[model samples]
Target: MYVARDCYEQGVKDYNSSTNPWLSSPLNFTVSSTQNKFVVVGCDTYAYLSGYQQNESYTTGCASRCESTRFMVNGSCTGVGCCEVDIPKGLKNVTLESRSFQNHTIVENFNPCGYAFISKQDTFNFSIDSLRTLRDQQMMPMVLDWAIGNETCNDVENKSNYICGGNSSCQNSEDGSGYRCKCKDGYDGNPYLSHGCQDIDECQDPSNCNCPGQECINEPGKFTCFCIKGYHLDQSAGVCVPNQSSLQVKLLVGLGTSFGTLFLITISLVLFNAIKKRSETKLKKLFFKKNGGLLLQQQISSNENNVQNITLFNSKELEKATDYFSENRIVGKGGQEADRSLSIYFLHSMEENHLLDILDDRVKKEGDKEEVIIVANLAKRCLHLNGRKRPTMREVAIELQGIRKTSDGQQNYEELQFSRSEEIEHSDVSFTSTGSFSIIASTSSSTVLPLLPFKTI
Candidate 1:
């Protein structure tokens, strides 16, 4: 049951009266329960009640007030002075309204207001002060229905509609309809136990059991167990203990061996890395000296004026930078070298075809290709059989330097003429007439060249 307390705490008064109309009965009823019906007492104010319901919508149940000949002597809403009405059966909610005849012009001085409600009868008692008093001294009690299941326990048990399981029973609902389920007596489990009820084991039950120095065993539908006179079950350990050791010495030995092997492998790796690094350093020094390291350094130091920038790189550095000398990094090496070698054969063939022109023109034309025939002419000129005609190493060096500077965009006619003059001064040996240069002994017994006339034939 539910009780609505504030339905009509204050009395409902007439609109024209000094009391507030908003506090009147009709507004109170609408504010209270929406489903419950109310009865207005103490005056046959039908028109006022009708207007109140019309304002609140008459579709809601109406209120009935007492006749005017019988005034509210006491606070009770009886037939003579108070009023009462039977609330609807399925009443869930309600509201109240109050109105006066002649707009309260007839009885406004004595009966300025009236009361209406659907309240419990015992809580409110009628009093004479209600006629002239401006307030209400009572609260309204309302009844609300509370139900259990929408289905009965019997219906649920028959159709297996309930969820409670394991040692339980169903009971009829206390309310008008439906039912509830609970565990059965002597069983501590769910009701609606269609799945099967589990029996309580009194021997294993903590509250009733006295298994001193014995084991309590739980059975499916019962329980019973006891330790013998000499033995007691260990409840804390949940198992029987035997006084025996179960360990192998070999296990410890194998674990130690595994650790030792791992340590040796780590040491071996460290020593191998150190040795490899030392070997690489020694190899780099060896290659550097073999590849004319000392000679290149001494040449550069002796000829500071002719020195050019030369960079020496370590093999490891080049290999690493070029991804270990990958094939893609080998530019102009394989096919290019083979093509150049073939071109030399082609030049030799052209030389055989026009030997005189190749010699006189100082340039060979081979298959519409302009080729320099300088190397053959220089070899012929340098390898004369007479001692006085071969070109000096100094003259060769100067001419080569002049040619290189000309390629570098340095156009010096004077330097070119000077290089040519030096070559001519030393060009005494004629290779076509003599097979080699003749060595001349000087006064100091050292080989030297005398100043000779520059001639070309």
Candidate 2:
């Protein structure tokens, strides 16, 4: 029999025919005696085979038997002091029993039983109280079973009803009787159950794996990488970044082009409007100066100095009075039409030959109309000749009012005559070598002389 060194320190006793019981000694020894020996101490005991024995011997010890208070069940040494052991190689069977010292009465208060058996080391720890009754034990009995095959996982998988799923491989158990399943690479989880192995997405976690500048697409048990837009990945850095300054320059150029187009449009529009407004103002000024505005002002100033009642009409007022210079309001007789048309021409010529000639002709043709003749002749003489010689139109107008106050039965003739006196004057003279005259007149001094030689009617 073999025992642990620690078990021998607990006072196991040894006995043999040649050993001396009188000498006190430690009970640790590999018994090599020629005869079988028994080791008994308190309630614990053991039997060892003699030297060189191929099989061990077993026998009963003293008759101090202890009551059986434990039993083994289901290969577990769990009930009381009784236990099971792994039998050694080539071993058949062994018998076990209980023993007690003092007939189990001296130490019955603590330990009422003892047991003996052989077991694998560390399988059982004996109670100290059991040593009190160790002497009564005879032999312990145990059984062992053995098996004979060393099959691998492949051999077991060849059998029907194998549990390994698809995408899985089997591995032999270390004991060599059974097998276990594992999923293929890129998969995880239990392979024995249906749909147990799952595909691993490498793109989900940023660490351990990387797509970097590319798109990481997970497929069945694998992944794919593709570069992003606007940047090519540098294999060294394994990431995508912006393109070079050339791209930035191109963007700036496009932006500047767009702004330049808009700015040109704005400037063109401003210039167009400015030019159009300037042209309009220039045309208006041209019309104002060309339409005798300066001449009109000069005439008005001269008339004012002479105390004449001359009113200067604005162009709009004159346009309204003449109905926009309509043809119907134009006054003349045949060739004299244009001379009487415009007021500026009429003013300059009214004090010349035209008014006097008209007055003389009227006086001569109407003798019974003496008062009318007198008023017309006076008005004619007042406004006659050049600027220095002519009387102010104010003076002429005052004399006419005096005649109107003094006239009686001649009022009708005077009224008709007064209206004609203020009519616009026009000359029909044509300059010639002989001084051609459309309307000729004789001066006061010349009226006393005879008619001229080449004079016509």
Model 2: runs farther than 4 Å from truth?
Answer: 1-150, 156-159, 174-177, 208-211, 233-457
lDDT of 1 by residue, 1-457 (tens): 1211111112443333322122233211322233333444444232122123323333233333443544445555555644455443322223344544444445444445555545444555556554444234344454444334566766776674566676666666442354556766556654554655666777645754354445667766556666644445577954333222212345666888999999999999999999999998888778769978778888788865465776766768898877798764553222356654654544464446543343434333332121133334444445444536767766656554543443332223335445655665699533421221111112113312222232222
TM-score of each: 0.25, 0.24
Global lDDT of each model? 0.47, 0.46
Question: Compared with the true structure, what per-residue lDDT tens digits does model 2 show for residues 245-319?
Answer: 647977999999999999999999999999999998899788878987677678777765554566767779989
Q: Which stretches of candidate 1 lie over 4 Å from their true place?
A: 1-39, 44-78, 132-139, 152-154, 157-457
Compute the lDDT for candidate 2.
Answer: 0.46
Candidate of highest lDDT: 1
What C-alpha lDDT does candidate 1 achieve relative to the native structure? Answer: 0.47
Question: Counting only residues 3 or more apart in sequence or on different chains, how many pairs clash (N, Cα, C under 3 Å) in candidate 2?
Answer: 16
